[model samples]
Every structure is written in C-alpha cells, then in structure tokens.
Target: MFNYLKELSFTRGAWLLLTTSCVALEATALYFQHGMGLNPCVMCIYERLALLAILVAGMIGFLAPRFILTRWIALLLGSYGAVKGLTLAIKHTDYQLNPAPWNQCSPFVEFPETLPLNVWFPSIFEASGNCGKIVWQFWGLSMPQWLIAIFAVYTVLFACLVLSQFKRSSGMRERNLFS
Candidate 1:
C-alpha cells in the first residue's frame, strides 16, 4: 500500500485521477446538498475552493509534461487543501458558531448581500455558512470530516509526487553531467 502511494505521487496520470476524483466527489456533495435540501456551510465552500484549485492544477499537470512547473502547481494546490481541511476541522469540531460570518455564509461567487469593499475580504474567509452543521453523518463523522480526510490524503500524495519528480530531475541532471 505504501509503495503504491509513492508511485501515484510521482505520476501525472495518477495526479489527474486524484484531482478528477476530488471534483466528482465535490459535485456529488453539491448535488446532495442542493438537490436533497442540505444547505452548505461556510467550511464546505472553503473545501470546494481547495478542491477547485487541485482540480485546475491537475488538469494543467496532465496537459503539460514539464514536471517542474506541474509539480510546483500541484504542491501549491495541495498546500491549500491542507489548510482548508485544517480550518474546516477546527470550525466543525471546536467552534460551533451558528450561521457563519456572512461572507463565509454565502458562496464566494454569489453575493446575495452586498458588503463594503473593506469588509469583503473578511467575509470571504470567515465561517458563516450552513455547511458546518453536522446534518449528514456516517460512523460519527460529518461531511466536512470526510472532506478533510480526502483532501489531507490528496495533499500528502501531491507532496510525495513533487518530491519524486524533484529527485528524478536531479538524477537526470547528474547523468547528463557525467555523460
């Protein structure tokens, strides 16, 4: 199992698969949330943004074989996912504030309520949505918990892949110098 994870981290196709799975999962969650009457909380949207970043990075990595750039982008995305997961976990577990900060409450793209430009940034990061509620649970874990697990795994995998690529590039450089 450990060896397989290492391999997946170094392969672009694997990265793409990881990203695609994340996108699909988010879509499924969204479908369940909107179609099934489960409104999302602020933490959920943060997770979505993190997943979006990874999805975009994976698409670019797949399309481009330039490992250095692709790996860097993936690392950035993975870092974002890690932070998002940590934030979600904290908000869901420790802080049980109902109706997250208004900005965190609404979708970033959809601003039902207008705020002054100076206050907009805080709204963007503050926790204010319904997604934080533990409406859906399995084995005592909530939706955000599941999301955090997935994103955390992805982040670790992405980091491993970046390291693997760096090692491979270093090896190639050494070989070229000796030749």
Candidate 2:
C-alpha cells in the first residue's frame, strides 16, 4: 500500500503534487481578490507568501534526484512553509469566529510601506479590502476555515512522506548490510 512512497521518491510527481496544489490555491485567491472584489488581510498576505515558498521549494525538489540531500532540504523547507501557512489559517479562523477589537475591522485595507506586495502585484497580493468582513461562505464555513482544512491536509501528507522515507531507507540499509 505504501510502496509508492519508496518508488515515487525518485520521481518528480511527488513534488509536482505540492507545486500544483499551491498554484491552485494562489489562483483561487487571485480570483477572489480580482474577480469577486474581495481583498485579503495582512495575515492572509503572509499565508500567500508561505504558500508561494512551498511552491518554489517543491519545484526545486522535483528537479533533484531522490537520494540527493537537496531533496530532503527542500522537503523540510516546504513542510515548514506549510506549517507557517497553517498557523496563519488558524489565527484567521479564530478572528473570524470571534470578532476582536482590532483595526482589521476597517472599511479598507492598507499595506504598510515596508510591505510593498500590493505595489509589486496588485492583482494577486493587494490588500485593498478589510479582513474582518465575513464576505463569503461555503458549506457554512468561512474562507479561513477552508484554508485551515487545506493546510491540515498538506501537513498530514508531509508527515506521512517523512515517515515513509525514514522507514524505507532504514530497511534498504539493512538489506544492503545482509547482502
């Protein structure tokens, strides 16, 4: 059942999955921001950056050989990125569930001069709208809740990958020693 973990370790498909997922996430975010006229908050922007980092690391990892140390490094970094995103998602979900006394309730969102993501990519990274506004909901859950669910899945997958690699590599070493 889990044999694919060892087999796929040498293939690019594994990293491709992460890369593809991140791209889809970014695309959906862009659609919401540009087409639906819903803007993201500061924390949401940070989440997007984390997702982008995962995407980039996944791409680089896919290009490396499976046994190479670089792939492990990339995987670790990607896992960290996913963890960062999940943390933000949890915070956002909490804020949505319980409205806090914060400046995020403003009618408009403004990016600090230090963070020029809006200026660099207005279409994707702009923060022109408030994050406190519960504008959209699907299946009775808000967007941040959905983001949390997505990140949870990624975290589990990464954990499984890590475990599978460790077990399989140790087994391989034992077989080599016996032979």
Candidate 3:
C-alpha cells in the first residue's frame, strides 16, 4: 500500500488526477454557491480566477503530455495563485477595508450589452465584495487556503516533471548508444 502510494505521487498520471480533483472541487463550490444559498464574495472570485487558470493549463497539458512545458506552465500559474491567495488572506485579517474600490474580480466574460453590430458591450466595471466572509471552511482554513496549498504542490510536481524530462532524454541517448 505504501509503495503504491509512493508510485502514484511521482507519476504524471497522479498529477493529472490531482488536476481533475481540483477542477471537481471548484465545480462543486460553484454549484453550492449558485444552486444553494451561498454567494461568492470578492476574494472568492479572485480565487476562482486562479483556479480557472490552473484548470485550463492542466487541460491543455493533458492534451499534449509535454513534461517541460507542463512544468513551466504550472510554475507560472502556481506563483500567480500564491500571490493572489496571500493578498486575499491579508485582506481577511483586517476590517472596514471596503472591497469595492479594490475589486479586481469579475466574471470570465459576460455577453455584450450593446444591441448594435458595431457597439460592444458596456462593461460596467465595478468593485466586488470583501475577502473576510466565509463561503466554506475546514479546520479554520478557507477554500482559498486549500487552493494555495494545492497550487504549491502542483508547482513542485511540475518542477519534478521538468527534471524527469531531462533524465528521460539522457537515458534515451544512452540506450541508443547501447543498441
């Protein structure tokens, strides 16, 4: 059992599985928010953006199966997510800081409001809610906290993948000489 767990942790398949799990978690959270009574706060939306980025990158990486590219993509995204998560957590530590003016969160993209063919949608750029409100939590850590952790892990995994690519390439060259 321990050996199996260790093997799973190091494989590309395991990373793919982890990506899928994260996607499912985000989906479930959204489902609960829209289907149930919970509404997303400002920070929640930011976190969603980070998660979406990761999900999209993961999907693309899965399609190509390039270790180096996948690792670089994960590293870039994980760093971005870490920054966002930290900002949100800091916001939550205080009060009376209006989340409106600081609102960097918005929908992925909404339909254009303009009726004419030439006119584009009037983007009502507005601020959103704060980071303090609890949408859901376990052991006192919010969803964003969990997301941060996941991203960090992904970053490391991708780095390993990058290393694995180099090792595999070198091994292939050696095998060619032997043959």
Instruction: Give candidate 2's TM-score.
Output: 0.81
Q: List, residue by residue over 25-133, the lDDT tens digit for candidate 1.
A: 7678668665776665665655666777777767765654345555566667666666666666556544343444542333333434664322465433343455435
lDDT of 3 by residue, 18-116 (tens): 568668967776685657646655455555656666676556545434344554565456445545555554554332233454544433333245633
Which candidate achieves the best lDDT against the true structure? 2
Candidate 3 accuracy as lDDT: 0.51
Please list all clashing residue pairs in model 1, or write none if there are none.
Answer: 9-161, 40-131, 41-129, 41-130, 41-131, 42-129, 100-127, 100-128, 101-127, 101-128
**lDDT for every model?**
0.59, 0.73, 0.51
The best candidate in terms of TM-score: 2
Better model by TM-score: candidate 2 vs candidate 3: 2
Note the clash tally of each candidate: 10, 0, 0
Tens-digit lDDT string for candidate 2 (1-179): 34566556557887888789899998998788778878777667777887888888788878773545766777787788879889988887777777778634444335678977678776676565556667789999988888899888878776766666665453343222123
For lDDT, candidate 1 versus 3, the one ahead is 1
- In Å, residue 178's CA in model 3 sits off its true spot by 25
Q: Return the TM-score for candidate 1, rounded to 2 decimals.
A: 0.66
